[model samples]
Target chain A: MQGKAVVPATRRRRPSSPDGLVLLLLAVPGIAWFSVFAYGPMAGLVVAFKDFNVRDGIFGSPWNGFANFRYFLTSGDAVTIIVNTLFLNALFLSASLLAGLILALMLNEIRGSLYRRFMQSTIFFPYFVSPIVISIMLQVILSGVGGSGGALNNLLSVIDLPQLSWYTEPGAWPWILTIVKVWQLGGYTSVIFLAAITAISEEVYEAAAIDGASRARMALSITTPLLLPTLGVLLVLGVGRIFFGDFATIYAIVQDNGILFPTTDVIDTYVFRSLRTIGDFGTTAAIGLFQSVVGFFFVTAAVLVQRRFHKESSIL
Target chain B: MSTTGYNESLLDHEAREADKPAARRRARRRPEPFTVASHIVVTLFGLFCLIPLWMIIAGSFTDETVLARQGYSLFPNPFSLAAYELLFSGQSLLNGYVASLFITLVGTILSVSSTASLAWVIARRLPWISRPLTVFAYVPMLFHGGLVPLYLLVTQVLSLSNSWFAVILPILLAPFLVFITVSFFRQLPEEILDAARIDGAGELRIFFQIVLPLSKPILAVLGLFYAVTYWNEWFMALLFVSDPDKYPLQLILQNLIANVTNATSLPGATAAQAAAPVYQLRFAMTVLTVGPILLAYPFAQRFFVKGITLGATKG
Candidate 1:
């Protein structure tokens, strides 16, 4: 038996066989897809190191290493993009977290399972509604009179208040975008937090009750303490993607209206416009590489911090 | 583990029950204040979520000038089917509908299966390759060279520039979908795969005949994600395809709505031109975009919550 098993095990199978190459075959189509569309673009990153004339081509171009980096640092748009992206993301993250947490807590506290389920579904529905749809909806609602359908104007008129022009105005967009983000994600985010809440030991709440605590007190002292781990993990993950923006949201809402640039021009939109419309592949690649490096460093740091904080309990 | 704490809290609340049985019963019977508050809050939010949809549906039924003045009331005013008439009346819209449906159908089927297969193979703890492959897949999410080279590769190298494949291929092998599937397959019982092998079935046979069928719930979830992504994706269509007949629903909607808005504001526009059934068209197309998914969602939605929660928790 041992001799027979050894003979079968040692038999070298043909790697090209349809059966034996399942993994290879399974991977090929996807690998080929990425190789061309995703990874092929890595060649463009070299443009940052070269003068990048269309005539010279990406590989044949003479190198001017670090010049692009230097140029980026000096450019005022760099500061604007960084500051704008960070601030917007920070606001979005905090607002979403707070609202999601409250919603989750409230949902968890409810005894009626049906209502909770219905609410959860409704709230999550917005998340599924594409950003493009949301953009058009917002345009109609926020368009001031003598402008378009201006639903908000109609609502305000009912209360005898003045209508506001939401478009062509940069100041209100950050708030508007933040609210939209919360609306889109609050219910979805709550699901994760609610899962964490459900995992909390009932005995801890019982112990808190034994101390004669009110529901509010129990929530503050016992529940929040247990949820810290989940919250920390979420915060770290959010911070990791601080350098990126929702390209769909930004593109749909802003849509070539350069007036909104100061408030809404994220690194993604800037890079896309530079590459597609202006035909500046080199600069776009340079900016993309810059964004990636910063993102990589920050994500690494965030992961390290998460590991250190919840060494054993952390799911991620 | 935490259930013990819950039991204790109930016990504490139940302390001295005999002395105030009526009060205790009332306390229990009256229901927690949180219950009422939760329902109220949730219902209000549900309405908040539904309002835009309601507005869109209502707007789609009204005249353009009526909508322009009323600004999307919940009740239809001067209700008209002119928008629907104009949309279904046109040959272009009908072609767009057919194109979008075909793309979504074909794309979802191809993308989901390919992604699942790749995900399953990589999900196994086979040799050193699995770990490296996962890392390789994840790298694109972190840093990608931007659009130009990708465009060149698709058009020049792959020679799929104007073909529907340009829109379909790049999105088919999404790392995010693969990551989701790998996470899903990782949770399945390894013993099932072992059992199939022990029964003398080939690996391919086991994967298709055993594993794929068992993974339907996750497959459905990923299928929905892919379908929605395909449906909403007008950017790729815009970049790659110029053929009006090849244009998907979203690209067509984008052109129509943007043009309508522009035309309404054009300096020399007449009231008739401004009110030329454009507002209703905007809402009508919006309805068309969301119609399929919304109809499909109620069936698969129960799976959605569980899938997302599981993926989130596991990650």
Candidate 2:
């Protein structure tokens, strides 16, 4: 009985046919996928250290210790790329969390379920939209030329404000990205918080209602505080990937726009350009290594914090 | 115990959202400032999310010259389907749709099955097997191995360049989804599994006949997630696939928008048909590409809402 989990009844009788080994068949595909795609890349990361040449291949290339890192450092692109990544992500994370919180609070207060669902459904549409489409939407609003201009320029002209080239405006990209981030994720984020708010015991609300507490007071006092743990978890998870950014959205929106790179460029985009346009695998891989190493630190912190909060069910 | 708590929270949410008729029937009290403000805020925010979409829909239907002159509007004063008409007439456009549908359907099935199977093995807590696999899955979440290696392996080593599998294989297993499914599976009654084992039901039989049927909720959640991912995939296509024949709808739309002259004109359109198709055509393409997801997401909303919240609160 004690060893039942290890040795099945049928397996005990058939000594040659081990159920333990057979059970492993289920995991073979996954393990193979992990080995080839996931761990396989880790081994190939050695290309970062070498001066990789097409003729000589990844290994045969001469070893250049830290030169790739040095070039990136001296070129000053490293600091800018890292700063932009952190700054943009920081803005996105804080803004998204705040917007989500507010939206959730508002949705929770709506007395009518049908209206609430309608608003919820409307807002969640962008989350499902492809970034390609989002980029097109951005262009439609931000193209800023007569006849070919989008809505924003028309609105600006209506207000008698000057039309400017939105694509070339580096100063405006951070804000644009933050707004885009919110548009894409605000509903999804709010839905999670709404669920947490929904999960709050009904008795607490009932008690408050009996005590003649207004809806706002209960929301700010009871709901906000109750959502903090969830907020903390999301924050930690977000902070874990601070060194990384969404390559798809950024690349889709700001494809090869050198002028906007001052604000919109991130580690992922930088590495991609270095790979595709420049064909410098060593420098690109070095930057990737930098991102992963720094990212790993925050990940450690996140895991440590999650462990303290939910020891029995650490997500990592 | 934890999973029971997690599941009950989801149930509580459903029960509250759907079963609160009494709240609606309550006597109308005068609205407070907060309540009024909330309505205003929610309405304004909802409009902000919606108006751009409206602009595109209107823009898509408007005449090309009207779109160019008026920019995009919330109203299409002169409606025309020339963009859609021209787009659908192209052979490449049809191929893009077929490719995107095939990839999304096939990718979702492969991804979901592998994810579920891996999760089941992990949930069983099988001593020798599960621990290492867990670490293997988990480490990628913490530290990515960088794109150069991944790209090189996909293109050079695996040689999946120009192949659809290059787009599908890398995204096949997300560790996050695996963990969520594992947690859900672990919550299933062990007594049922034990009962099946005692009745001489093999592991695979039990998995097929029992486990999968019981876990439809998580499967739906994950299936939608994967389907959306595969449908929206263009970056992977950009990276691995170079052939126009294999371009998904997103990739086609991407290429169309990036340079309206390239694939935008399409092969079969006459000079007159190709003329003046940029502004309105993009809006039309945007509508076609995103329309399916918009229509589908609403139906799956409840499941994803439950799925994400469960994953979130449980974390």
Candidate 3:
């Protein structure tokens, strides 16, 4: 009986044909939903090249053949919007990386488990807070009128410094937005790095200690080097997303604050404004297509490069 | 054993290492100045994170005159419940709450069920379907047709505009959640599944009766994620729904904030109301919008941590 059982287990039979069919049936709803929502829109991207009239409809519209693309390219806001998007994303990426790494290293150095966990939870709280709320909080804290005697102004008066109008200052928004982004995201990102640090085998640290390596030396030589793969993957992914501005954050914080538009406006807000205000379906679609294509290429190139260097960590 | 249990054991083993022989333990636990500096820095940073939330709460309860005069304080000298009274007095706030609750609860259920079922099928490595299905799932993550086409599809084709369904459907089954669920389902032991199959349990039975029962933690984690996302969502309403009555809490809060800010300059009853109470009202609205999630956060923090660890390590 034991021999027979061993033989059957070792020579495990293929699943029956009907089971395969059952699995397919189970997957049908998800597939159908994706087909409508995801793939169908992908197929509809052709509308970007067409003059999409309501009467003519999506596919029925006459082909305009790059006219939409030409319109956006020539609009002159294109360069500013794209440049703002890339520059802001780059700034955010570096700030968030630096802040997250510093916090992770700091958190790792602390010895009390309860203190570490409490700090981790407190810092991570902001990631879950809505951008809308953050915007409101910012207004309350910074707006000269909305926050009549706003917190910042109050502090400035106490310190004998002149109160500055925060919202109207376009020059300050890039820095303000970068700081807010880092504050919101740094802790959450650091948790990833912390996990990576924790996953490092203790034997390596023990061996380093035995060799008379100090804590700082071990962290620099052992922990940081061992953490390189995780850092590398995150950095590559961050670069890939350089073109994709966070729409929610930008929109909520800088809403109709036209003075700040020169500095804060990004590709996402540009497309959204065009679509909503001008109701230009074709041009908006063209810009969307441009972003999608560019993003796809960037991500693919990153993944390829990642695969070349560290095949095991390549997402694909 | 649970992943947390495994981690705790690892930590315990390290602690044991530090507790061994006095000389070695002292060497390991050297009193470095950096430790003191790090604690100070981390504690200050933690306070920095908490201060905004603290201000929001304090500003909400402070007397309107005091709040305007004081500009938000750690402790409201003259506390008032007027904001709460105003929030509760309105029918609109209640309506917004009901709309948001319905959307979040129903959306999370639909999202979890669809994502889990699909993830299970793909994770099973079934004949002729798994590979293509994976590619199908992943394609959306890499290449979306962009928001224009999706908006067009939802409004013109599906005709779901001006309804709560519009808010729910767009976010129903995110590819990221599907991938997370897939990775989690894959971690389940294959031997147990084979044993169940050999016991004549059908695929449906195995999935519903066995796999789901074993996946409580991951499902709870994913459910909290979906709930928070649906609860926080205002973009869908901004794009699709126009009816003020159907506006979710976040959208209503957004509009209220805009109105309050705009009212400050305009001369009218709105400006009169905006003079003192508006500051408190803004804080009140913020608290109301974020209050439920904040209250629930500590209970869900464990699962949230686990979820992040799962995504980070596995991805």
Candidate 4:
């Protein structure tokens, strides 16, 4: 029966059948949507060069050549904004990566499944919560005018420590923002690393144990080394995205707080502020274009490096 | 019970072997000091994550005057329901909930269906379309036109501004979800697909009858993901939608916070209204917006873990 089925299956396996057309039809909606939304916007990047006027439209707008790009690059705030975006993202990436790795390692050491599950679920709760909601929560916990007077300040007063004005303080924002980023994302990212760690075969650990290796030694030497590839891929992706500031977190937490703008303002917020406040479509578009171009190159470089080091792990 | 007995016997055998002089060193089974340390660390971290949420919930229940005087507390001093009352009493809050529900439901359905369809097509390895479609899917992941152009396409070209479509359409076919689903579909036993094909089922028929039924777990996982994303979505609405009536729950909450903050700054009659324990109201709003999804999370937690593991390992 199996032999007969195989013969028929071989006969039915035609290459250029009408089923190809059917599959193509199935792909149409997605392809069309991507073209209009993804690639269409990509082509619309040309508007960065053009003077984008509402009356003349994206294409019909008069060409401004490099004026938009030139203006953005030369603007006094450009260097500061770019630096702030990179610095903040780097801080977030390194802090979250370290925290996530440490947490995953600790979680893996846990013996009871139920306790581990509870801990993971609790930690992942914030990842699902909207940043907008977090911003509100942060206000209740940090705002100076609150009844409970931002929780931290209240705690400080109780301890006889001076209360710091978190919202208005520029120098404090980078640390505060990084902590918030880690708080929101650390557990979620740890889950990814934990998944990777769990995928490591139990046989390796058993062998290491038989060799008289302590659990801590085994984890440090065996597990951490094995997790490096996963960590490398994640880190590479993080470095590639160093140019992109988390717009939602920054926007919500430091909305129009000009006093804190020195540390808090990033390329995303700057561009958004420009578009909203100045309505300079060309300059903002240029800024957006700059970010996309640099981001694309970095991502490509990371993929290339991944391919070189771990051929099987290359995302591209 | 049977499994535990078998494991004990296996352990006895291993121990007996370890006792032999010829045998090599055996692994220790006792819990180490590090295990206790690990528990303490994890518990501390867990508390760190849970405390903020606890504080918000407690603060929401605290009376306005008490909250004003004492600050946020782990336990409410003079508990009251006024914050919740204010939230539910307003027509905007109810309207925001309606808008959010409609968007999350409709958006998830549309997104999952389209993603599954595209993924199925790509996963099948159809003669001419598979390779190109795969590359097409990835191009968007690597490079995007950035916000300015995307905003232009949505507002100018598509003219979806201020409409729910603006919120729904741009996110309907996320590249990440599509790729994840594609990898999942690709892992489905090819032999079954071959059998279905030999049974004279067309592509669509096989997909609808056999493939989709086999794909419920992944589809459910993706649906939950999309639903959460849509529920949490406010940024797109901030950019595109200007009408107050069209605001989603997140945007409404954001506006409420912004209005309160803005109102308090100005020296006017509105400042008095803004001074009505806005922190407590904000906390209440936070609970209202995030409560349902957080509640739903535990139920979906198993599938979320499974889906992510599959995607991570395969991708």
What's the interface RMS deviation of candidate 4?
6.3
Model 3 chain A: weakest 10-residue lDDT segment is A1-10
Residue B255 CA displacement from its true place in model 2, Å: 0.9
Order of quality (TM-score): 2, 3, 4, 1
In model 4, how large is the Cα lDDT of residue A58?
91
- Candidate achieving higher TM-score, 3 or 4: 3
Considering only N, C-alpha and C atoms within 3 Å, which residue pairs clash in candidate 4? A147-B67, A147-B68, A147-B71, A148-B71, A148-B72, A149-B71
Over 4 Å off in model 2, which ranges? A1-17, A144-148, B1-12, B19-28, B261-274
* Deviation of model 1 at B88, angstroms: 0.7
lDDT (Cα, tens digit) per residue for candidate 3, span A163-204: 988887899899989988887988898888887887677677
Cα misplacement distance, residue B32 of candidate 2 (Å): 2.1
DockQ for every prediction shown: 0.31, 0.51, 0.45, 0.39
Ranking by DockQ: 2, 3, 4, 1
- The model with the greatest lDDT is 2
By lDDT, highest first, what's the ranking? Answer: 2, 3, 4, 1
Candidate 2 vs 3: which has more lDDT: 2
TM-score winner between candidates 1 and 2? 2
lDDT of 4 by residue, A1-316 (tens): 1122232566433434666687678788899989988899899999899988999999999998999999988989999999999899999999998888888888877755577778988887778878888787677678734423587888888899998788777998899889898889888888888878765766787787778787788779988999998889788878878888899889987887799899989989998888888988888899999998888898888878877877764544
Please write out the lDDT profile of model 1 over residues B58-142, one tens digit for every residue: 8888877777665677788777887787677566667777878877888999888888887876776455546767877777776
| Cα lDDT, all candidates | 0.71, 0.81, 0.80, 0.79
How well does each candidate superpose onto the true structure, as a TM-score? 0.87, 0.94, 0.92, 0.91
Positional deviation of residue A225's Cα in model 1 after best superposition, in angstroms: 2.9
Model 1's chain B yields a TM-score of 0.83
Q: Which docking band does candidate 2 fall into?
A: medium
